[model samples]
Target: MFLLIRISQQLINGLSIGSIYALIAIGYSLIYSILMFSNFAHSSFLLMGAYTGFYILILLSSSFPLSLLIAMLGSGILAVLIEKIAYKPIRDRGNPTLYFIIASMGISIFFENFIICTIGPRFRSYPRIMQTTFVELGKLNISVMDIYAAVVAIAFLLMLSYLIEKTKVGIAIRAASFDLEVVGLMGVNTNMLISIVFLIAGILAGLAGEFLGVKYTVYPQLGYITNKAYIAAVFGGLGNLKGAVLGSILLGLLEALITGFLSSAMRDIFVFCLLILVLLIKPSGLMGIQKQDKV
Candidate 1:
């Protein structure tokens, strides 16, 4: 019975963290779907969101909802600015995809360094907004924060799903994902659509950042967590939102179980090994469809 309880606890913990990963991976996948390039700068948006929320909480006395909204809005505006200032020029010039990738890397590096230089590279904890409390259920003790995180993550994901699957903009986004050039020719404002995609992606990343900041310390390096999310995105299939969520949950569960039973040291090793195994066995990812090269 004790062992069962331990296992259940780890499972719940895994789900909570996995839900966070899903948030980040979904945003990453959304941008990839429309742009056909990995936005390494996405991590910077996460960093920006974290810092923004941290400052808001510190200054505003733990107004969680206000901080969340402001962080999301700030990050969304930053994303739009990035698109217009950097990516749009590249897009207009009809440069190769490599240029976009390099530009994103540059932007990411700039943000990281900018934060380190200005913020002094020290970790800061968020003020206690939610109590460190636990809920007991059937001999299993679960963290309230964990439960809250999972619930919030699911709620945001559902809203995203509804926006994508039900709205007209979503239909256009789906069409753009298939063939961006064709969509532009079809009278959709491709620029506006792309901006909206970036905005949504940034907003989600910001929310994830706030959750992470509350769960752990806020630091410039906090964005590094997005690496795992990137792996989850690839593991589930890049550009596939459903696959991203599945991959994130599975990865979270694997990490939690491994940490509980084995050692924390083995957790990341196992994750990378799993990534290697997936790439070797199924390069197209578990849910990704293989595409043929145009001759």
Candidate 2:
């Protein structure tokens, strides 16, 4: 009975963390789907959201909903600006994928160092906004914050699904994902569509960032957690939303079980090893479809 309870607890914990990872991975996968490049600068957007939420909570006395909105809006605007100022020019020039990757790396590094230099590299704890109360079910105790995080994450993801599957803009985005050039030629505003994608991605990342800050501490390096999200994106299948979510949940579950049953120290090692195994065995990932290049 005790063992069963323990397993259930870990499953709940895993689902909570996995929801957060799903938020980040979904954003990353969305950008990859449209742009065909990994925006490593996504970490910068996450950092922006974290800091924005932190400052809002500090100054506004823990107005949680307001802080969440402002952080998401701020990050979304920043994403659009970055897309216009940095990435748009590169896309206009028809540069190689390597260039976009390098540029994203540079942007991520710049944000990290800029925050370190200006914000003093200090970690800030979020004020106690959430109740510390736990809801007990049977012999298992579940955290209220975990429930909150999971609910919020699911709500946003559902909204995103509605936008993508039910809206006209979503239709264009889907078309653009297939062949951006063709969509542009068909009179779609490719640039605007791309900007919308960035905005949505940034908004989701910001929400993830706020949750992460509340769960842990807010620091410039907080964005490093997105690395795991990236791995999850790849593990499930890049450019596949369902795949990203599934991969994140599985990864979170694996981590939780490992930490619960074994040592926390071995969790990361096992994660990387799993990644290696996946790459070796199925490079296309669980749900990714192989694409062929035309000669």
**Pairs of residues clashing in candidate 2:** none
Model 1 lDDT on a 0 to 1 scale: 0.90
Clashing pairs in 1: none
Per-model TM-score on C-alpha atoms: 0.97, 0.97
lDDT tens digits, residue span 1-295, model 1: 8899999989988888899999999988999999999998988889888999999989877578899999988888888999999999999999998999999999998999999999879999988866478899988777777778788889999999999999999999999988899999999999999999999999989989888998888888888888899999999999999999999999999999999999999999988998999989989777877777678
Each candidate's root-mean-square deviation in Å? 1.2, 1.2
Q: Model 1, poorest ten-residue lDDT window?
A: 285-294
In model 1, state the lDDT of residue 1: 83
lDDT of 1 at 202: 94
